[model samples]
Target chain A: MINNFHSLLTIMMTDPTNLLSLGWVDSFIIIVYFIFVLGIGYYLLRFTKTGEDFFMAGRKMTAWIAGLSFVAANLGSLELMGWAASAYQYGILATHWYWIGAIPAMLFLGIIMMPFYYISKTHSVPGYLKLRFGEGSSMLSAVSFGFMTVFMSGINMYSMAIVMKVVLGWDIHFSIWVSSITVMVYVVLGGLLSAIFNEVLQFMLIWLGALIIPIIGLIETGGWDGMVERISQNFPAGDYTHLWSTMGSFQDNPMGIHWTGIVFGLGLIISFAYWTTDFLVVQRVLSAKDLRSAKMAPIIGAGFKMMVPFIVILPGLLGLAVILPPLVGENQVSAMNPHSYNEVLPLMLARYAGPGLLGLGVTALIAGFMSGMAGNVSAFATVWTYDIYKPTHLKLSKKEESDAYYVKIGRWCTVLGVFVSIGTAYLVQQFASIMDYVQALFSFFVAPLFGTVILGMLWKRATAAGGFWGLFAGIGSSIGMWAWVKIYPGALKYIALSEHAKDMAENMYRALWSWLICVIVTVVVSYLTRPKADSELVGLVRGCTDIPSEGDLPLIKRPIFWASIVFAIFIVLNIIFW
Target chain B: MIENKGISIWFFIGSLLLIYGVAITIANVYEMISPSMEKQIVLRELNFGVWWGILLVIVGLIYFINFRPWKKGNNNKN
Candidate 1:
């Protein structure tokens, strides 16, 4: 049955026409999408009068709105294109980043961490650092995070340009300008509200657009069983089907990442850091209407997050099982091109989607790009205004400022942020893969930031000095590791299993080492430093903080109930896929 | 008034769905009426535009109705 589907795919591939090219109807659909997005921004502009409205949606978003936006902000071109490309390169092992890498951390955030964040009422993650660890730690966090967000926005811009250039044959520079301009106009005018609203809409469109490919592919290849059979037959050496079977040891996996790296490096450190701490994602949850909604947002996001692999990862597996054989033929060595693998999602869309749906799919891709850029830009603007600019520039000037003054500054910062992102996008051209670059950035910034935050929240003894130094040391160590690998590529052999393993699993080991260094530094420094008084630490540290009790809500509606359900499903998925 | 009523989010969502539906429907109909080889090929495969459009329009209408000031419920807080 799989062979029959393979033959059919081959016949389609033999056709002279490129499946990925955009037709008039498709372009029209994309145009309509843009117009609608701008229309929302214009309409919401009136409501965005106050800084709170612009920065945090006036703190009035329900669980559904905030939850959808929280997940959707993350469902950007990076998640769509980079992960699909990763799937093509690394097989089903890439799903680990989505499942074990995301679910538990999201649950931990909703159940354990949201109370601290929500009750504190801080505008950004760095704001929390300011309250807990004083000026030095907060400044370091704000500066690093400000720089990181702009860089991330630039990466999103670069990824969008690459996809457009490949799929629509658009000029890369032209694509970047159009997308950056579109994002800037809306974000500057309507602020985070516009971004979140578009994110919710994009979430719907993306599912509508991308879901069809895997469904059709599954039908063509005779379901999961057939896909597995076909993949093994075509490429027996490549372990593309199994997820955990390959994860027992570093040598056992196609990803060359051992269970320790997958569970500890990615699952604990990287995932926790991203979901709990990164303002790009956390900002949406922070905008929730109330405490209960805030707590429920990540839980809702986790439920949807666990299912994302089916849409994103399955296409790459299909590409491997069915599409790659015809294009590459039997001589896989000469046919190896990393660039071509990155085009898997676009190629699959071109193959499956016709005129109208084709438009929707392309529009969905653009939406993903725009939302990602907008999320980063908005987060940057907020952190800059409240955390950095407010304290440093505004305070020094000694001029009393109104809420509207900060809102104006937020708008200006949005413009500045997007411009910086455009510059960063050009810098990203030197990198081979966006995924590796993004992971490297996460290691440098997020790992240490999380270490500082976790210790501050759990251990009241963690002083201002410890927080600052621990974060500084963690970031410095990650940069050193990256430089060491670049200068002495053989350094990886000590940590990784083989030559291939060293290259593939470098980010995992770097994250592990950096996180270890951060924890050690923080613990030692905390013991030596003077701690904040118990009164000053109230509602900030875990033991001293009061956890909110569910009021009048039924058993099923409670956060604990939903978390259990999601975790049970998560465990079941791992077992089945194992 | 709309901001005070806290219906912007509802209206925004409704407008998005309605606009998407109308766009898809128009584009699909145009392809059907003045068909090119590309349009014919695309149409022949799986023209989900009209059906999905109609579904979205219905959903949009439901949301739009809920956005009416008279229909504002206890959860409507800005």
Candidate 2:
């Protein structure tokens, strides 16, 4: 057993440099994957004839397709690389973002929010906001979302380029251009359907590509207990293994976030904003054929989401346990720099996967990057065409244009969006860490958007003026807090309760404060402003809307039944990990 | 037209194998081309990509032939 373990360790610790080089088979596999993606887009182009087809997949998607796309769209290189890096840096505590931060919000979206969104038959989140709170709130959200989507697309582009350059010595510009052009082609041709199809395909690839590393590592370590023991031996950070143990206070955790900050700031504010309101994710559910499928989509996504941390996070722990120590030992820490912890996933892929598998793994990373970019650009195209162009450009014309005309505009927006994303990718070069920058962006836009959305949906009294100002207040507060943290540098420690928690606290606490400010401002302004009549708000607000009755399905087939089972499993996992 | 009953199970299975095959081929080829002292011990032991790729291709082809959507029927919507 001892001899076998040592041999396994020796095999796992093969020189990292050799792992970076790709062979012919790997290149062929990658080429094939790209061809498959492009082919699917071309094939789907015939189906996307009208603007509705372009933006919403003709509202014909089933529960599984929409559900897979919903989860896959979010499971980009950003999530994989960013969370893996976070897992390396913050340990199992990073799992909070996946479980508490995502699952609950996703479940809430399916159960509580899908009814309003589906019943309204709006084209986008901004369109729904327009129906609920009028043009003022809608325009604010549409413009903000437009910019956010393009920026996020660029981040994915930049991340993909960096991985390609680091792993295969590919030029960063070459990588970015190849991916951008490929994503632009399919998205422009087939629109949201193409993106959704590719997202589903990429979802499968990501799982298959990523599954091997953890399986190999666990076998070597003997299992979960063995991995925990080996990790402790190598790193001696007991807190890293336990999820909730280190989360007692800001000072106690490697993440430097207290339970209050984790539970409220991220779990409540950031997660809810991203899961329930983000157009990129919500648009998938909105594409479902019926209300039941729309609601079931997110419930299915939540179940899949619960299993994701094991795939993305475990590799980071494996890197910390097996890969980093040898590099650190050799005084070659520069090779595996702690600051560029995002390299952890790529590094593990190189070490574990041989040629053919290696190609698939790399293709998986590329697919993730493309799927993320495609999702963002498609969502951007929908908002830009419907909200921005239709209102500003089409409104000026005396005659109403055909659906084909709008489809043309959507295609143009896809082209424009991709170019803008390429430009934004260059901007991402300035950021030290992709995840931190992404989280900060989310706090700035999503947190505030959530504030208005929540108020508009739940409180019929939320006037257009109140929704607009509340959203504005939330965004302003988030930016102000970000700037304050930058200038003072020491302020986060004071606000967050521990000196160690300062960096992460800046984002979490900013989200919390921004949400508070938005809610407060909205409530105050709502009272001052005259709200729309109940007639105008029919089917828009919770009280005014009729709940779609669930047909008498069997317990096993019911969404609520599956959601409860997921929640129970989530509780058990947390307790065990705690 | 493909029914909204979701993607066929056989098609999904075929795709998964093809992906696995391609991935394995890439790994094996990389090992063969980039031979080193450390790699020789591991790479020489496992040259599974080509055979695996061939096997997966055959299985995938069989599935595709049996479950091709075009053969089932077509819808005028396209």
Highest lDDT against the true fold, candidate: 1
Docking class of 1: acceptable
Overall lDDT per candidate, in order of appearance: 0.79, 0.78
- Give lDDT tens digits, candidate 1, residues A1-578: 43443243234333333436555556566776777788778877988999999999888887888888899988876678778878887888899988999999999998888888888888889999999998898988898889878887787788787767656656678779878898898888889988898888788788877886787778778899998898888788878877788877767766667787788878988889889999899999999988888989999999998988988999888877777543331234253532367778877776666656777887778888888888999999999999999998756998768999999999999999999999888877876576466657655888888888988888888988888889889899989988887788887775444455645477777777777788889889989988989889877889878877797789978998999999999999999988
Model 2 misplacement above 4 A? A1-19, A324-332, A335-340, A428-442, A493-499, B1-16, B19-66, B70-78
C-alpha lDDT (0 to 100) for residue B22 of candidate 2: 53
After superposition, candidate 1 runs with Cα above 4 Å error:
A1-19, A324-339, A429-442, A495-500, B1-4, B8-10, B22-78
TM-score for each candidate, following the candidate numbering = 0.90, 0.89
- Tell me which residue pairs clash in candidate 1: none
- TM-score per model for chain B alone? 0.65, 0.59
lDDT of 2 by residue, A1-578 (tens): 43443243234333455336655556666777777778777877887898888999888887888898999999876678778878887789889988999999999999888888999999999999988887888998899899878877787788777766666666678788888999999999889988898888788778867776786667666788888787788777446788887777766876667888888888999899999999999999999988888989999998899999878999888877776443222133564453256678777776666656676677778878888888899999999999888888756875677899999989999999999888878877875476466656655988888888888888999998899899898899888878777788777765555557756666777777888899999999999999899888877789998876667777787888888988899999999999
Q: The CA-based lDDT of model 1 is what? A: 0.79
